[model samples]
Target: MELKKSSSKQEEVEEIRTIEKPIDDSFLITWESPTDPKNPKNWPYARRWVQLVIVSVFALLGPMASSMVAPCLDQIAERFHIENSTEKALVLSIYLLVFAISPMISAPLSEIFGRRILLQAGNVIFIVFNMACGLARTKAQMYIFRFLAGFGSATPMGLGSGTISDLFTPEERGRAVAVMSLAPLLGPTIGPVISGFIAEYTTYKWIFWSTTIFSGFVFALSIPFLTETYPKTLLGRKARKLNKIEKTLKYHTEWRLEHIPQRKLVAPALMRPLKMLTTQPVVILCAGYMAIQYGILYLVLTTYPVLWTHDYNERPSIAGLHYIAPGLGLILGSQASGIFIDKTFRFLKKRNNGKMAPEFRVPVILLGTMFFPTGLFVYGWTAKYHTHWIGPDIGAAMFNVGLMLGWRGIQTYLIDTFIIYAASSTAVACCIRSLAAFGFPLFGQTLYDHLGYGWGNSLLAFIVLGSSIITCSILWFGGKRLRAMSDMVIFKDE
Candidate 1:
């Protein structure tokens, strides 16, 4: 009996020693160590929430910079002697073009370098270029600086959702996503309103100067708070630290003479998103739908100033206030989506024997599609007829509501489908949407001129409604089959 007891104690000691040894280089371990405080998932709730808020603030700054100049476009045109409205709108829209394309470079870089570093670095670049915008002496300088600033700003747009995914579980992700998602839409809405008043009180230069100052403050705040959240990068750092300690301890041991193996970084980490973009049918469909919806939004935004100032004879400040209607719609729609997205997931999970498929997000998308064109039609007809101002505002609000709902549905669905590659997937979607934002406004003047506001907007509404209907129908019918068809769905354990 004593011998057996001794053997048991020996085994316990061996197990403890094994646990203390460094993990194998080949083993894939998730960040779940209960003692590892560096793991974001294990962070204190307040700290994690604060980190999320900071990331959201970074997210907000990008969109705010994008749209802050919208209210002051006329003044910019007059100052620079830009006679063409299309040329004036291009200065605003081209920033989005840069936003669309820059992510192709930035997203992959984040995967390689790490999120916090790239995000902070990008902010510095953005701040410099944004300040340059305030000092521009000509239209060329303004255009170039805006584009460069946009390129720097795209980092947050691509990585914000990824940051949330890194910290939150699938069940808790809805609220985090709600907050992250709100930043992009809310920034655009609030930017113009505040910028309008600022422009009214001061000069066009202050718009750029104000954003630069705000960005600098956000950048300063981010330094201590935003730690590296990428799992591979964190693990790599931990391994390096452990290696140094192990080497120091092993100096007196026989094992010290042998060479240590270095971990090989996977190239696929940089290439996976592009692979997914090319091969993933779900990504393609969702991206296409998102692009169309975003294009329509930008088209309306570009035309809004022209309609208010030229048609209604409203001053720049009052015209900018009109954006509030869409702002209200966006908030209402986003809140409703936050509640319903999870509810829909729960209902579908129950229906499918407690298994939830990503396809469950499709139903809300159909509802959004129905409202999209209806809102467009109302706004178009009301504006063309010179109807009551409330009519157009209500129409704008309804359209914004539909845009938010559809956007949230598609975004949640993509994240669910590609949780591991959610950032890149989102980046791909954002790229197309940003392209539309850049290009749609350039043509807005021509579209309205040829067809007038009524038919011009009506045409766009018809196209968007038709596209949404087709895309949603395809997803509603084929989504289950598509999910079943993909190896990703079969492999997903949670």
Candidate 2:
């Protein structure tokens, strides 16, 4: 009897080997070879980019809906006869609340069922309920519709990182992750700009209707093109096909020939993001820093109106234009960081004698740590002293640039570190970050009111500095030691 060596670089080979029986050759099933074109990592660059665009579009729709209603809150309140400020805000915050909760369920399902079904199905749910939000006549109805739509919206956030991992190697994922990660941060900034004009020129209902229409376009476009990328799910399908073609007298199904761990919640195929959150230190720090960055992004979204409308005496439509400042920052940051993160990773890999670790991703965030607080200080004091409007706009752009750079770095690091469970790790990160996005704005008005814009932003800047130091230090200095201890990590080296 003879044995063959599985390819060194193939994930499918690694998965099959993990579950291979030493004594029996009868049970093993795997990809035909390292270069199997069906393997998503082996997919042509054009096809991979198509998947990235589709997934990124799907991911963009969620946050677009989340913040699209921001400029329309007043109109919504007037129509619903709502008087409480908190209740008015809940219409937006409740969506984020559900966004946090639903991913715990969706991420694990992506692991089992594959990415395409969950993503498309989730978009359908978002489309249906988001349109309902436009039709709602009462505050309670608005809250319910928004929450349900958010449940569906969360699917992309939970699963998109894992899809990038599926299609690209660690060396190539940095740029792909940068584009996908930009959607969530950039969407909120761009949302208010669109909605502000709509609310000013037409009915607030158009905001919801407009987003639903765009989402429908995205949903329909994705149907024929998007395909499954999960290796376990793909391999299982391959095994089932082989079993039928070979006409095996003794047959075994994918359920019994498992190469991945299973955890059941309400369904046998479902797993929990909470399990990953509780156990992984890399996830903890990555999610925490991302959360802080997310919280700051939303807080800025809330405060932009105050600076432009009340302080500068601009109309709603005009004030909305300020969002472009941050929007430009996000685009610039993503493009610049995209090029450098991959270069940095390859450089560090060469230095380490062709070994690569997730820690290489952490250095990019050093640029973020500096920009994050400086942007805040500049924005805060510029607004505080009533300097030229361009001064604050520049500051806002700087802040957004920082947020996105950090966001892309942390997300790529998590996907690389927990390669097999990228969805689960990303799901937990979404859970924490969504909570921050929800909670931070609830206090934005009060924080700015009590301390004034200068001091309040300075406070946030200080916190950003502190958190970045703690998170980056742990990852840069101690990440390898921690990976050695973590069972959850899959690509321990590359």
Candidate 3:
């Protein structure tokens, strides 16, 4: 027993010796090491911007595919001999439904295989099915193709944030995010406009064909430029290179390729996001707010045609052009948010003694809440009373501005709060929001039919207003307490 105990103690000491300790001397910080060059954050700005553009292109393709089909839904249904408008609407919104569930798999896969591989693979999947969508002859075929395309398209949604975090420091992320964020919002708004013109001039199938061509272009462009950006993946590569160098020099380094546990790569990749989603209060609150905001966006999208065509007697082309107003709002709002979010973060960092907290972004949410109900009331009442087309357009623009602001605030807050697990954290919020986007439109027509546009929209506005107020209040007071309790923050401190 005494011999065994001595051997165990000796083994423990040897293990401790193998682990490298941090150098305390400040002079060592100035040394330029091989590892320094490999860090993505230190990469040339041109390379970083190229990566940003590639990921943004991937992000843009998904939303374009989603909404491009909107203008052609009637023609698609008629060709298939399906008469129900609600069922036809399902073909368009069901893609978003598939998107909600796919990230569960894709998010984990990105963590496992690396972001670039999954992104490229997903783009291929999207392109194939998107082509199938053009060739779909039956309603069942269309639904299946759209669902598969959506699954493929979900890759960029979750991976874009992780990529940004990998490549940019938190302080520099705002502008990159601004460009990336524009893709998804602007894609949907512009897709319908372009598709409407195509549908009017040609067959409905061209809508799918056009997106297929776009996706092909993106895929070709991404092949050379896209590279793995995840930290674990990059670090593993570095460790391997270091191991080879140590062998050549006949000197042992502290980091050993054999010492890295296989499970370290697998376990955290799968469990971290799930843990963050289930455990974090901030994630829960932000997710609920995002779900409501996305729901309202879809509600308006699904009902706009009903309001414009039936109530106002506008042509499809003209009605589609109306989307441009909201597109303009989203662009302007996103650009403004990029500037303000960074500025607010810096100001709060200074105020907090140079320590930045996630709660600093909450002010933007308050601003968004104020606009939420006001826009809804304007849109609802104007359309209900048969007011001029410009009135509803203005209302949509206002509502979209609020949506963009709220989205940017919540997204940045989540990323700031859970830097290590932001991808999974954002995934949870996105899942809930995508589900709402899918479900809200299904019932939008029914609610408008019975309650009329005015009262129905009023009810929606009230719900959003109440939720927004509650969200703002919670962030204002509870955010500080919650941030202190967060595991990510605790981990960072240690």
Best by TM-score: 2
TM-score of 3: 0.88
Q: Please give the CA lDDT of all the candidate structures.
A: 0.75, 0.83, 0.75
Candidate 1 yields a Cα-based lDDT of 0.75
Clashes of each: 0, 0, 0
lDDT: worst 10-residue window of model 2: 13-22
| Superposition error at 433 for model 1 (Å) | 0.8
Q: Tens-digit lDDT track for model 3 on 239-341?
A: 5565576654222223332245555766666676666667778878898999998888887876776677678887788778988988887887788778877
Decoy 1 TM-score against native: 0.86
The parts of candidate 3 lying over 4 Å away from their true place are: 1-21, 24-35, 244-268, 484-494
Per lDDT, the best of the predicted structures is: 2
Superposed by TM-score, candidate 1 places the C-alpha of residue 227 at a distance from the truth, in angstroms, of 2.5
When sorted by TM-score, best at the front, the candidate numbers are 2, 3, 1
- Candidate 2: how large is its RMSD? 3.0
Query: How much is the lDDT of residue 487 in candidate 2?
Result: 75
